[model samples]
Target: MTDTLTVKSQRRHLHPAALRIMHWTNAIAMILLIGSGWKIYNDEVLFGWLHFPDWITLGLYAQHGLQWHFFAMWVLMVNGLCYIAYGFYTGRFRRKMLPIWPRAVIADIKAALTFKLAHDDITHYNAVQKTLYVGVILVIVLQVITGWAIWKPVQLSALVNLFYDFQGARLAHFLGMTAIVLFLVVHVALALLVPKTIGAMITGGPKVTADPDTDREPLPSPAE
Candidate 1:
């Protein structure tokens, strides 16, 4: 009982303020970008015969939506940089995330295949979660790169060239957006399935279990 208490108590500080801020910022930026981008597509969709419905998009008009999209793009870019820099400078990636071992992913997946895979503790993300997190970052990077390439093909000719042309960049950007939306769906679903994770992200962390002998709450993080 004592050992269990110690392990659970360790979750007192689940996410640093920096991490939480970046996370929610990125989420908001992504949502805005998606809505605005869909509206832009409604004007002239590159993909298929189907036009993105105007009703589902932001601003009620193509030009208005384009403006919003550009604004959201800037927000995504700046917030993304902060997220990356914070992860690197603070060692958040090394310490809290990507703690994989030989066959650990396979083991975790197999265990999760039983379909009760919700993990409550922020300190104990499984291999599958880590992999998904990494994937989401990569997708975000791709979105940024391709978005920049399309936004200013002439100014960013070098980036556009890497994708072969603006056409290629646009296609890649569209695919990146699709991937991101799908990931968001899975991410939210998992959060709902997990106990206290979404709440922890919002308000620092869940109320931890104190040992029976002590009625005191855990001390807050003294610094970021």
Candidate 2:
């Protein structure tokens, strides 16, 4: 009998280092902001179910919460700014973030709702993913705006006035936080649903199979 060797071709995608840094940084910042924000809100009555003592004294006072909130906001803002700059400079934003056609987005949304893989030929984000990604980015920007409206009311009074009042800004900030929480829940659920996706992000590459019958091609690695 003759011995045979098999060669497997794989595709690389994602920038592991960049992704790791951004992911962990964002995660930490979000956690800090949420915790501190909750503490501050507990000082008043936003919802009955969310109640905490006005003075916890466990290194989580309202004043301390404000400090942590601002600190974490800066971290998220700076990191996000850098990520955006890199995306534009490297042209990845154009490739990955530019909205696909409405028909394509609708198709992807239908496929996702039906739990099917929509595009076999496309390797990058599907239309639905692009829309969600863009939506999350806009949400984050809104968070910054509302956050500033609360943080520096005197300096940003004019901007805050657009929203109506400091109370309105507070409401906007709370809503933004809630949206982020919901997004995170869905994102994490999807990650659990798609194990390969988690692997791709971690390994910076995707496993591929070669077959003459299949229409899908290997995904390309993130540009150097």
Candidate 3:
């Protein structure tokens, strides 16, 4: 009986509070940045998807889009930095997030797309989730670099020169935003498809039940 209890505790579902906070905070910040970004982008009507009035602007001046963009950029940067720090300190970065092997990652990706759970019987984040999580982090880093080029073309002239001058930076920035938007769309869709995922995020606990017989396992030590 004691052994069974131990196993149940080990298999208990848990997610760090820090991760949950960062996840929601990042979502909100992205929404704000995207909305404000669209308003700024209307300066030249870059995309025809949405329209904004020229006179009614959020920034001090029509050209002040850069100011708002920079302000929001700082929010994202600071939040991301904190997350990275936590990931490194806790070592959860390696144990939980970093895939054990390339084959594992590939298999996980396949499982995630097919909505199949692994041996644990819970469709927690399969391979695709891990890939996207890591990929998005890389995208954020690139966004920062391209953003710098756009914000300070003169200072970052060398970097901007690699892409295609200031024009290239602008294009990169647009693409980065598009990438996040696409990910968010798919993420939300998947969450709706699997309501348990949404609940898991909100509650910081798995919505799936573990089998008493086979699900018993030792809980990994908490990250130091």
Candidate 4:
């Protein structure tokens, strides 16, 4: 029984099925929200000179965009909540994302700029990734608050007031959207640079061995 339990415990993957599902669900929801959001933004013209072309925007019209935006919002919110819960319950966040130090972040940033940042251990997140992931999570929460404020200024007047007013909330929402977009761009670029990460998300990467002293087997060299 002891040996059987040990073997079963070691049968883990870098990206578990639940995590992959939530990740892809969140990605699709984000894409839908961004496209529909651009459509809605074009209707209001946040910056008079800046407008997203209709061809790229979702929903085809402002009203339809609003509908799609709300639909995607629910999907994202539910999926995000599930992801957060799972992370906490499984201690994944604590293990993979905690104890981020500024010194490490700076070192990692420098290493990244110099093209020396290592990607051998995809199971662990580097400081730069930890910072970005936490920052983007906060941005998503901000988006939700500002979105509510803009959607129903009177009903959610407190949220609107927190941002200063209705237009303030709109501006906040726009900025949050910009942050998410920038994060996505960086995220996609990083995934492309380390293509195995993408494969891991889809296929769960390599099996993770459970041991008190270490987490994984010897990884192949980066050059391989």
Whole-model lDDT per candidate: 0.77, 0.72, 0.69, 0.87
The root-mean-square deviation over C-alpha atoms between each candidate and the true structure, in angstroms, is 6.2, 7.3, 6.1, 6.0
TM-score of 4: 0.91
Model 2 stretches with alpha carbons more than 4 Å out: 1-13, 47-59, 118-123, 207-224
**Lowest summed-lDDT stretch of 10 residues in model 3?**
214-223
lDDT of 2 at 10: 28
Model 1 stretches with alpha carbons more than 4 Å out: 1-12, 206-224
* Model 4: lowest-lDDT 10 consecutive positions: 215-224
Model 1 clash pairs are: none
Per-residue lDDT of candidate 2, residues 106-215 (tens digit):
88878888889544333478887788778888899899989988888999899899879988888889899889988888888887776666666667554433332321
Candidates in order, TM-scores: namely 0.82, 0.77, 0.72, 0.91
**Per-residue lDDT of 215 in model 4:** 38
**Order of the predicted models by lDDT, top scorer first:** 4, 1, 2, 3
Off by over 4 Å in 3: 1-13, 45-67, 100-124, 206-224
Best by lDDT: 4
Candidate 2 displacement at residue 64 in angstroms: 3.3
Off by over 4 Å in 4: 210-224
Model 1 score (lDDT): 0.77
lDDT of 4 by residue, 1-224 (tens): 46666566556888888889999999999999999999999988889999998888999689999999999999999999998888776667777788899999999999999999999999889999999998998899889888888989998788789999888898899999999999999999999999999999999998875553333322222331
